[model samples]
Target: MASRPRPPPPAEEQVGQSLSLGEFQNVQSLSLSAARMILHAMINHRQKGSKDGSIAMPETETLNKTLDYLELFARFKDQETTQSVENILGNYDELDTFEKSQLASLCCVEVDEAKTLIPSLANKISDADLKDLLDQIIAKRQFMDS
Candidate 1:
């Protein structure tokens, strides 16, 4: 014989508000959807009711300054040096403070080599000025570390 359908449980005997695994996954999915909605709202707010829906890139002065500094490095050096410098500075914004300090340390080696080759640098700088420049380099390094 066919069995009768089970009666619906009373409201108090129904599942409590506690979440199960599947319910938790649903909640996570909803949270992600909510975050996307919030981001959409923000972009819309930034657009200021434009009909075409084109979002403008935010101004990035710091990135421009960093690129300008990289370009200055490129101008002073050979083509290969410029390419290498570009590769190093391309992701400048991604580097942390320690990585920046490490880059400075690498530059100190070049400064040391420059000091050694100063006498051979066409003798444009006088001995006193070179001495002062070396002193300044030392002072700058100390000041940066502090």
Candidate 2:
């Protein structure tokens, strides 16, 4: 009888192509592909058009502003992430509001010791700001749930 060697397990990374800065939580692995995919699904999923659809690129100003915002957001976050929020948000701006908001939530959690972060977050965001965001989010959720 011959003995066989056991196969090693996959590295503690590259689990899903659907993770983002705000969504990384207790991440056992931080696959770059998974992170990119998550951001794409969250932000750029909407930019896809019909079979003959056109791809409209944003103006330089909008792109830059968006980039700045995402970057600033990531800086404020306090978690370790596979990719920068700027990278994800900049690449995924084509997604719809719901998806964008979801992605934002995922990448910028206020919980302790998450795998990802967004500095100066709203939970740590002002009470008034938090209230507004919560109300709006709740309203949006109600609309979506309905």
Error of 1 at 30 (Å): 50
Candidate 2, residues 1-146, lDDT tens digits: the string is 38888777544532233333333333333223333445445445445542237664443676557545554443222222223432343353333233334444453233321212322232333445443443443444344436
* Native-structure RMSD, model 1: 22.9
Clashes of 1: 0
> Which 10 consecutive positions of candidate 1 have the poorest summed lDDT?
26-35
Per-residue CA lDDT of model 1 for 30-136, tens digit only, reads: 11222233444555576674555666656368645644554443221233332343344334443322322223232333434543532232233444543444444
- Model 1 residue 104 CA deviation (Å) reads 9.8
* TM-score for each model: 0.24, 0.24
Candidate 1's displacement at residue 43, Å, is: 19
Stretches of candidate 2 off by over 4 Å are: 1-103, 106-119, 122-124
